[model samples]
Target: MRNGFAKTDDLIKMFNVSPGTITNMIKQLKTEGLVIHQPYKDVKLTEKGREIAIQAVRRRRIVE
Candidate 1:
């Protein structure tokens, strides 16, 4: 994202998913050490997460 961080509400709206889904997803990411979430704030990707994201985007472009 342009801001490099995503709030829970934004994630829910962007993914068209429920709040519970975002909460669970965030929890998983946190457990995996892929994201840093601040209570009542936004979630920022860790370096490892950013690398994975870049790889995914590159793979998508190549596949497409």
Candidate 2:
């Protein structure tokens, strides 16, 4: 889920979430400038999003 883009279909399969749920989440991420999403295309993270994701991973590792 990092270092590259992911299609909505792939995300759906991975998360087992509804399409509407993924759409809404993508919309929210777009609003936050954290992702670039278009209908029928892959989703990519912005630099800000990537940094945040890395920090989250580090935090999770610390917690574990």
TM-score of each: 0.91, 0.90
Question: Model 2, 14: alpha-carbon shift in Å?
Answer: 1.5
Q: Alpha-carbon error at 53 in model 2, in Å?
A: 0.6
Full-model lDDT, candidate 1: 0.92
TM-score of predicted structure 2: 0.90
RMSD of each: 1.2, 1.7
List model 1 lDDT by residue over 1-64, tens digit each.
5489888898999999999999999999999999999778899999999999899999999999
Q: What is the lDDT of residue 28 in candidate 2?
A: 97
Stretches of candidate 1 above 4 Å error?
none
Which TM-score value belongs to model 1?
0.91
Query: Clash pairs of candidate 2?
Result: none
Question: Residue-wise lDDT of candidate 2 within 2-64, one digit each (tens)?
Answer: 559998988999989999999999999999999988888899999999899899999999999
